[model samples]
Target: MNRTPPSARTGNRRIRWPVVAGLSVVTAVITAVLGHQVPKSPSTSPTSAVPPQAPRGQHRDVPGEADGVVPDGVTVFDDAIPAVANLDPGLLKALRQAAKAAVNDGIEFGVNGGWRSAAYQNQLLRQAVATYGSEEEAARWVATAETSRHVSGDAVDIGRSDATAWLSEHGAGYGLCRIYRNEPWHYELRTDAIDHGCPRMYADPTQDPRMQQ
Candidate 1:
């Protein structure tokens, strides 16, 4: 009798296709879920990513507009220096208006000196004397605290030569006049100048009668 081989019968056995297909689908679903949960890098756009900067002249609230010295009870513009804050309100207003007009002609005005406390004026006078080697010589440049227009908040020392020249020519329109011929930077509100040109400048502060008093 010929015996059928048990190995030959099992050799033709087929794999279970349904089980494999089911396992493959489950694996794909698990992979998709993990991929979906993974964090992705954030995206940004030009408008959304950057912060805005403050425009010039809008930084009045910013610290230290000039030398970190703001006068008590005084407010100044961002474009202006601390010195402007110390000036008389009327004087500062006139200066700001003049500066605005000068800007249109490409001239930017600045204040090197304005109102000064009596103590500050005295300090300046002392420094001037040291530089010039005598009280008399210093007097020509700086006035005593008692007589200083700066202390009275009636004068301003404009910064920059371009601004000085512009004021010399057009300051009368704003009632601003250079008080000292030698110190062309010094200006005062001479309301009369608007109607009758700025009075002739004295040779220097020393030459003014007000200084004698």
Candidate 2:
């Protein structure tokens, strides 16, 4: 591709060779020393271990997928979640009233779990069995979908020690009673509790006659 005439080429070849060769040598040496022909740019974002959730109802159902899933920070006022929204009107009303009063004492009510679909309750029972290593042991913790108070929107699991403690002290007036001594967070609406005080706890769900159903 050299377009110069023979005479001109001969005249300039010697003068250009050293400079061109020197530049080439310098570039090769730099490339060798850097161990790359080009720099590798860093990624702005790295991939996460957990996959991202699909949008809304379009999401695929895994074992844990169910209507009563209450993520952290869901409160009694959060009607957007099916767990809180589908609660029994009487139970929901009592919880809301108690939550409103709790604010005056510097306590906010956070809902851990509430009204669960049948599938959700069954999932919980399976989880309980896995955790306890036996269905008999698990029965003390979780109930069948048909018998579960959560599936009927009659029970709720409140969050945080301080909030439960506040409820323990004052919940009876609102007809909110802890059903299980082992589960301080679990509460149910007992309209009679407002007048007669809370009935004896069942120790765990296993003692409750309703679980036999």
Query: TM-scores for all candidates?
Result: 0.63, 0.70
Q: Where does model 2 exceed 4 Å of error?
A: 1-60, 63-66
RMSD of 2: 11.6
Best by lDDT: 2
lDDT scores in order: 0.79, 0.91
List, residue by residue over 72-180, the lDDT tens digit for candidate 2.
8999999888899899999999999999999999999998989988887887888999999999999998999999999999999999889999999999999999999
The clash number for model 2 is: 0
Q: After superposition, how far is residue 134 of candidate 1 from its true place, in Å?
A: 1.1
RMSD (Å) of each candidate, 1 decimal? 12.8, 11.6
lDDT of 1 by residue, 39-111 (tens): 7767976678878887878843432434323444332243354567667787778888888888899988766
Q: Which residue pairs in model 1 clash with each other?
A: none
Clashing pairs in 2: none
- Model 2's TM-score against the true structure: 0.70
